[model samples]
Target: MSKSESALALPSRRALFKSRLNNRTLMRQVIARQESRRSRNLSDAAELPPFAVRVLTRMGFGPRRTELAPQSAPNPNQVFSDQFQRSPLLGKDDVAYFESLGRNDDERLERYVDEQLYGNLPDPEWEQRKAAYPASFDTLDEPLSTTYSERECQGFSNYVVPQRQVERAAFARACYSRRQLLELIVDFWHNHFNVFSGGDEDIYVSWAHWDRAVIREHAFGNFHDLVQATAKHPAMLHYLDNYANEAGGFNENYARELFELHTLGAINYLGNTSPLDAPLLAANPYSGLNDPLLDALNISDPARDIQSHYTDNDVYEAAKALTGWRYDDEDIRDENNVCTSGGTGAFFVNEADHDSGGKVILSGGLQNIPADRGALEDGEVAIKLAVYHPGTARYIALKLCQRLIADEPPESVIQAAADTFYANRTEPDQIARTLRTILLSDEFKDPANWGKKIKRPFEYAVSAMRAAQCDYTWRFDDRDTDNFLRTYEGTGQRLYWWRTPDGYADDRAAWMGSTTLVQNWRTVDWLLDENDDSDADRVMRIIDTTLENFPGNPTPRELVAFWCHWILGFTPSGGWVGDVGTYYAHEPTALGRACMQFITQQDFNGEEDSPPFPADQQIPREELRNDDWPNRWHRRLRGMVKLILWSPNFMQR
Candidate 1:
């Protein structure tokens, strides 16, 4: 048979086994030789390759990858010779603009909160304040203690304060950051203990509570403690309607998501294994060996399968358990003629609303659990029961490792991390130790894994701004108008603009389409020249300041080529340059000389002194002209930049 046909043939089972054995034998020999060499009391020290370092950084948190070519390494000032930091991309002035906006946001949030607490405008210029920070919708003649309006105070109560603080805390940690790993942990925990900002009044306070009590306190702590805090937090209680859980009404939203999303992945028949196969069938979905007994718990269905089984009843039970715990409304008044009911911030468990009969919780923790602690004190016992489960440890460890390493982390790595979690059950902060072990492991910084994650819209936008040094702000007076747009953060045009609860999709295929490609090209145009209102010399200086060690090649032809290289990071091959040149070859280099020939025929922008097209070239005047000369010329430049941005090289760290 021909070599190709032989290669395509499937190997026999014996041949496959032989191949695996050979690979294992080779690896073992390499390790044994390395160990023997090290026995002379010498350390086997090897610096990570440059590409590996870049990959490691991207794996943790996406950053712009510099040129990985060894000869293109950056100099002492920390810039590459071939690259110019200056771009029609972001510039130095943009950083100042964004930072200024950040400061203004801080001031606005402070004033808005102060005004809400004291029952009066915090500033004497309150009307001007109304003008400056107009509410999205008009308030009633007087505002109610509880409001669902898109008003600034309530909006502040919802999206702004907690987000700003979380963002600021995260940004601060990013700036001059020492604890690199903590930032990754915060991201993991934030997604893990997600709170829908638009949930309710209590969520305003509870949002902050989850961040402070659950995510932040134990972000690097033990998985057990993190889950416990999340289960008990007032924000989670209200967000998931857990506060409303009671005997007659069980809201299993918390319970269901806690398992399917937060803890153990749902059990199902493997795609390869037939469901009818008894040997392949695992444990019952409803009950892991450790599920709690609900006889004393008084659930809607006492014998209900509250285990891993995802029945319609499970969601109901999950939602019901979260009932009755609600926010203290500032407007609520008691019969004694006083507004005494709503204390506002704390998690209040009302006895009248609680299901007091005993409930057994079935969890994987059955081996060591102290049994259902009998009729519990409202939410406290339930919270503890949810948090202290063994499944929480494994679930949390898996998530942390996934974020730091890969989504499908090695079973050994997860087990090691989970072991750390189990060992430190009492001190919930042990989760961080497990994470550190994972991140610092050889598997995490692997070359094959570099630049593997598709950047989410927000990460894409932020990383682009940081990379290009773009200096723009979304700080217009009517801020809520911009929040939706801000979701697209990298490329100016908003991304998918998703309205669903799933947040944004996390795959590259979602962004790789013709429309997005056109949008990306448009952004490159805007970054390069459309936003070029500032002086050209000033713009160049901003480029010099931001891009390090540019000008890798000093020749005239190479200078233009090098600019493309720094901006695009890859050298254009002959075929590529020929493609761009094919469009422009018909045109003369000089406008003055060319305009002499075609000045009367060319149209110009309305400005009286606006220049006309080059005389020697035929410019398409508003006919769908992708193929015509001038448009093609524009496309050549814009295309190179766009290709750079869209190319896999630009997609890396």
Candidate 2:
């Protein structure tokens, strides 16, 4: 039934020869057949693509960290997150008190509004408030001034801390649980409806809610409603400056992004990975002047006479219909000048500030506005109208399909997801179901797509730590090391705070550069070294358990290739081990032993690019190349680990 069993079934040579004396030719044919079969089996091992091997290792709880995930049948990310979910934030009473203070009971709600605008009103002038909240701090480099180094700036800022924590917890869950699908979902949703953590007041606070409320809530839901919900979110409002928009102060930042960044990006075909050389239009209306239609959408645009489906004037008119909105703050006084206890922390509508008369939208044309519309209700309607546009479905569908399927998804995938979006209408949960259909579809599981995607830094870093079985106790209070993690949050990959409202670049071309490769390699080295520092025994245990049957009796070259595939997800091309293999051939057993030491030496973190092994380790000197093979084997194995760390595969994913 199996190879080992069949081998045992073979008769002894003396008995076999005697029995087969009259059938020598038959015995010869059987021997030849056995030899051929062995060759085929060995070749099969080599045929597995490096990428596939890497993908399996990184995506699944493979041998190295199987304990983290018990080969469970269902979701991986969920199992992982559940394992580490905050144990209800101990001291429930304190948390409850804070939460209760922000609760929206009717009396507290009215009082809260009163306090936000008027309670702290300086007697002489409200001019300071208006000055502090300028109409436009439009340039990318303006408004926010920073003198700290990248690392230092990241340390002090509380922005993006929540997301970093959430992502790490999700990663830990994946590494330590059987639910692989859950990790995939977290990544999918986070990317699908991406939001930057840095921005103005409402957005700054609202981003806290968006991570779980908007993105995670509808992660597995329908794409349409996810877009719509995000559009309504104050974080989106603040980030896109929609709250700044007024009846005459039209800003298309939100509207344009509703199309470009959120739903259907500028590129027409789904998941096309081509670099956009054309002027990059903003995902929100306020991205910049690169777009003619968008430039016209700016509140200050003078071309008021231009006739078009969607124009700056229309955006301005829309903004006017949705003005006077402010966030709910416990310490804040309302416009009427009273201290308040509770209200929703969002853009509030000021009836006086809103120009609620009927207006014309370029795309929808002359829509009648309700006469009694208030800021909150009017803004909600505007967001709804923007999200329900015909183009919105197509835009959202393509993005959802891309996140679930491929960077280059098929037309069918887009169509299917889009159809689901349309059917689900405005329900976020329904949209998640549509996404689940795409994630669990035949197309998603195809072999051609196996490892087709590259690991984002979030995936790469967390997976590497998991592979090494590193234990991390990340705490928000631990500012020193917390700073390092925070620096990497959404800043690396050039997605730094205040960089662009359009969000991070999400394709291969955007990520695969020499700088990124170097950074990745350095990061890998740091993590490996950290793993060694944290728990050397645990690291060793993971290696032993993970590579139990690696390459079966592999040659030196095969061993090198195997390590690459197991860790980095790619086999080194032939040149990588050509010389090493030649040396290894002289004493296969000895060279094989060297691999273990090589893996251990990866503990060195100081200079990531420098080779970790001693020069003597790479080549066997005559004195060390003795027939007493065990010692020589140890030396050779030491070299293998260094080479493994330095291999190209480690640099990529």
Top candidate, metric TM-score? 2
lDDT of each: 0.39, 0.42
Over 1-70, each residue of candidate 2 has an lDDT whose tens digit, in order, gives 3442231122333332333222222223333433434322221212233322333333333223223211
lDDT of 1 by residue, 211-238 (tens): 5556756766555556656666666666
**Alpha carbon lDDT of residue 198, candidate 1?**
49
- Choose the strongest candidate by lDDT: 2
Q: How much is 601 displaced in model 2, in angstroms?
A: 13
List the candidate 2 regions with Cα displacement exceeding 4 Å: 1-64, 67-194, 200-207, 222-225, 264-317, 330-347, 362-364, 368-372, 426-428, 450-452, 483-491, 494-498, 531-653
User: lDDT at 86 for candidate 1?
Assistant: 27
